[model samples]
Target: MEPLEEIDIFIFDTLTDILFDKVPGYKEVVDMGENSFFSDRSTYLFMNEFAVYLGGQIIADRTSSFVESSFD
Candidate 1:
């Protein structure tokens, strides 16, 4: 695999693991062929729907909100 491909795989796998393990009730943690961690050529996709569902909420919140910086 190319370096870029390997990097993509690592990042995707890490995110999936975090989404399912650290996050709660995250469904659809696995990336199916459409958004697979391995590659576009990947044959299958697996995910936990509950984990992804919750993780989506968390990710959405992060993307939607901004935090203020304190001078202290």
Candidate 2:
């Protein structure tokens, strides 16, 4: 499997095809850095959108669920 960054780029490319001819920069702002441009609303929107994009992908599910479960 590719690294997280590669997977993210791949998904971003695919989403651009479905949503628009050009991918919006705001759509790719969900970085782990403290200074990411994405607001809370943008973060949630991106997350939900990616969840729908990655339906039935166990790697994605495990990654998210592991983090979520760790916080529980």
Candidate 3:
């Protein structure tokens, strides 16, 4: 298996933080993916959700609310 890149680690850590705060049994869910090579449906769904959330976070982080307000 390939090692996770730096960005992958960042996303995983961010997702872990978010999931640990918001979801029950997140460790089990993550373990399912890690153990199964992500063949499980639950793991797949969680990864998809994490990716979407991370994408949104990245966009939000890069954008300035002040800049947005200037256009109004």
What residue runs in model 1 are displaced by over 4 Å at the alpha carbon? 28-72
Query: What is candidate 3's local distance difference test score?
Result: 0.49
- Candidate 2 backbone collisions, by pair: none
| TM-score of decoy 1 | 0.38
User: Candidate 1 residues 1-72, lDDT tens each?
Assistant: 999878867766775566445433232323332334334422223334333443565566644321111000
Better of 1 and 3 by TM-score: 1
The worst-scoring run of ten residues by lDDT in candidate 1 lies at 63-72
What is candidate 2's lDDT per residue for 1-72, written digit by digit as tens?
A: 559757666665565444322323223323433223223324346556545444533345646642343233
lDDT (Cα atoms) of all candidates against the true structure = 0.41, 0.43, 0.49
Candidate 3: where is the Cα deviation over 4 Å? 1-4, 29-46, 49-72
In what order do the candidates fall by TM-score, top score first?
A: 1, 3, 2
Indicate the residue-level lDDT of 10 in model 1.
Answer: 75
